[model samples]
Target: MRTVAIIGRPNVGKSTLFNRLVGQKLALVDDRPGVTRDRREGEAELGHLSFRIIDTAGLEEAEPGSLSDRMRRQTEAAIDEADLVLFLVDARAGILPADETFAELVRRSGKPVVLLANKAEGRGGMAGAYDAFSLGLGDPVPLSAEHGEGMGDLLEAIEPFLETGEDEDDEDRAGKPLRVAIVGRPNAGKSTLVNRMIGAERLLTGPEAGITRDTISVDWRWRDHPIRLFDTAGLRKRARVEDKLEKLSVADALRAIRFAEVVVVLLDATIPFEKQDLSIVDLIESEGRAIVIGLNKWDLVADRPGLLKELRADAERLLPQVRGAPVVPLSGLAGEGIDRLMGSVVQAAEVWSRRVPTAKLNDWLAAALSAHPPPAVSGRRIKIRYMTQVKARPPHFALFGNQLDALPRAYTRYLVNGLRETFELPGVPIRLSLRSGKNPFEGKKKTWD
Candidate 1:
């Protein structure tokens, strides 16, 4: 894959431009200068070109004998690994001494450089663009990174250097087996449950809680589907956390949650509803991933009938975001309910990956609106005209309507629930977005008329 590095002095909108190019906030951005101390990488596409873009720490003069030297070394190492460099400068601040020094350093590397004069939103930055000419990096591409201006010029500048072979390989890998993470509080029997499903003593069993420190991923075949299962450390509340190693373990689990396509949150049967468990569910919902609940150690619960009723009620009350999600009961030690647990995992994953055809999606929307019209508000009746599925890692629906700004949360939830039930999409998160716009053909006569 072709590599491009965004190199610049601090507070010059490098991270913002990085986010814009990558189409995601994979790198952290802040107003404070030099907030990014480490190099971050993300895959980016411009028109038909695709490349790996790296965002590096700001280029600055390091104190000869301080921690700043370490940062400078890291930044230099990242720059050395790039095929092209985007040297960004703050046009509002004009060309400074640091910019001149970095320009020489980048020129010496002999890589293709695209000098960007960022913050060029208005007349205030014209003089700074002129001043940037002294850096000898050719004409600057005047841009406003925050406002998403000058993207065309920036893309044109680097179009000749992009390589395209990697895109074919990426498309080939898109349908490969998914990675799943199983996590919850300590003593939730996550390891035991995973071992039961795999039919081996693959993970260590223990009576003590918090036995797993590092997140362990195991690759196995279920029926004919290839699966990678991750057993993560039990997450504890922030205030209760003490040791640094445990804190790091929690962070690792969180990272696994982000990396995995599906997350199975194991809950102790006896104490199934806790604040931490709810928080875990909320995290998965916020991350827009599919989730299934495993009520493990069910063999230990004495009141089986009453416990089942309570569990159902609690799940509905706590996780309304993912309504109708599957909650399977299993005893990992006894190898009971393993089939149901695996079945639920596969079902939820299938739903997570499912895509709806645009024609069928709009057809369903038309029928649904006819059956139950949106409520009237402020003497104006809400008219939902059409709908489309924009993007679907988990199905996200976009609705074009009149007066959609007044669409109530309850009505949105109602549509989401209807979609889940009608489409057989259980245990996966579904998003519904409403946008208001005027019809372009509102006053025109139809040909059929």
Candidate 2:
């Protein structure tokens, strides 16, 4: 896909424009400057045009070897990789010394630039928009990103730069790779595990905590099956996440989870099942992705026999949402048990995509309701009429019944557990959607009982 990068000084509504183009809020937006530190990429569409878009950090001049400098390097890297650059400026704030500085920087890169004067909804910003011609990039495309004003003009400006061609055929798309994401707390050997899996040192790894600040995806094949593995930044507790850069990294990792089909929650075996670890598992279940618990750093705990059994018990007890998940003990550094881990991953993906027939699902629901009837509410029994599988990729079901909104939490758990056990659907989260029909005899002067 043709790539375009959004670049400019801090807080020029770059992320807001990015979210608008992608038709979703994939990037975090804040009023403060420098809210986005690392670059994030998403597939974007404008009218009939389709291409990949990148949201980069705010360009800044900082001291050598500082965090700000690192962010600058990421932006420069994006500029080098992009086919076109959308240089944005705050029309309301007017052109400043920083804007002039980055304009020179983007000019020296020799790439095609589309000058954008953002936040120009009224006549107040037109004076600054007219003054932008002094930068020598071109005429500015004035538009308000917040309210989406003047998009037709903006589209007319960039249409010539986009590549035009037919898309790939169905046979080519049938071979698409499976997406798997590795996520956990800081310094839990996620990058190391990725390196071992791909048999190459592609990612930067060290003993320090939080060495990775971006969610990197690597494409490879495993035993003839193509796979795309996502190595994400370590997620920390919200109370302790005080750094703005770390917050961006966490948001990137969460986007990775929502993109993947199966998620591997790698826990440090020495201190397995901490509060943070459980929290991570809960997040995965909430996302409704297939779960695989990886007990990394197992070599250090090899002397203690029967610890794996105890941890298995702990997993079943602590995380009932993902009970019966595959827990594999392996050392990412030593590369032990990788084959078993891959096998479990493939199996989990199959279960996650499995579909049950409507007849079979209705039969199971009948047996379950007969064996243990639903509890009464306000001296009336709730009726569950029928059930059917709505979709797959972590099985989702729809239940049609009367007064379904008043169903108790315990009864919902009972149904979910029964679905998991009876259908042989393990480790993947099941979604039960209650759909109730309105009563017809309401306010009828006691016409029916």
Candidate 3:
């Protein structure tokens, strides 16, 4: 991965800027100087640009054996490893002696740099931003990372230093790894499952609840496909999450789920489908994510004939929103049935990202309308004119028709269900929206041929 390092002196809002760029608060931020002591790295994006970003400790002049000296060493190490450096300055503070010193150091390294004048949001910092010209590190990208101003200029400045008009990972690769998050209530074997899949005890796991206070990610190849897996903290009722740290952890987990292409709602097979579990699944579906249900701790189950079948039925009856979502039973500790769980995950992702061609979609719609024509309202039947998929990654469609405002909800459900069955889009939510364009000859042409 191409590396972009954010470098500056202490308390110049480097950590805050890093969090803003990454779109997540992965690094701790404080008003105090030297709050960040270690090098933190995350995937970052600036408009169309995506790269690995490193956040380094602040640079300072310190005694040879002092902690400040060690922090300076870490900053130097980050600069050495960086392909591009974002030399950040506090525009409100103007050009200081330390800014000039760091500018000289960056100049000596001969690395490409995008000078950022942070905290230059309003007229307050304009003069200092102009003063940055004396540092001789190229024209500064004057902006505030806090309020996110001047990002367009920043992206323009950094574009020339990036990987030539392509994302770092998307240059001619056949398929991108499926980003999946496995989330559940606390003590649902989330960490244990991650440890088993990686074939190592990388994550701390035990019988204790709430051991994982953050969302941790790992990459692995499974069944000839790349999988980027995120193991998240178990979510509980918001009323129960009084602790500040747990609240942060929960927020972090929610961010993971939003970024994920697919999500596995891991459930304790022993106590499956608690109220919280259903709510979590509701949240995933509401986010328009592909979902798979894993029945963890299956080894302890005293299996009865038709028990698994009945359980799947319950999933349908309970989760009518994601009515046909896959529910796979597995033991994360024993590594049993993992292949099945992965298979379901892959299948769900495929379905989630599946797009039907416009021609095929119209054909399916015609057939569906023929099979079940719209019911008459009073004396007139609603006219359905055109149907096409406007987006994928959850498969949203727009239907241009007349009298849609008066159409019943049951009829809309019929169309949605018909699309699901006709396209074989099982385990994926189908969105069908009704639109009216006021075509002059609306009912004359009932279908798109």
Give the candidate number with the greatest lDDT. 2
RMSD of each: 12.4, 16.0, 14.5
Put down candidate 3 lDDT per residue, 284-315, tens digits, no spaces.
Answer: 87667889999999888846567688889999
Query: By TM-score, who's the top model here?
Result: 2
Q: List the residue pairs that clash in candidate 1.
A: none
What ranges in model 1 sit over 4 Å off? 1-175, 199-202, 438-449
Please report how far candidate 2 places residue 258 from its true position, in Å: 1.0
- Candidate 2 lDDT over 298-411, as tens digits, reads 999989989999999999999999978999999999999788888889999999989999999899999999999998889989999998775577787778898887898899
What lDDT does the true structure give each of the candidates?
0.82, 0.88, 0.84
How high is the lDDT of residue 85 in model 2?
A: 96
Error of 1 at 371 (Å): 3.1
Better of 1 and 2 by lDDT: 2
TM-score of each: 0.63, 0.66, 0.63
> How big is the RMSD of model 2?
16.0
**Clashing residue pairs, candidate 2?**
none
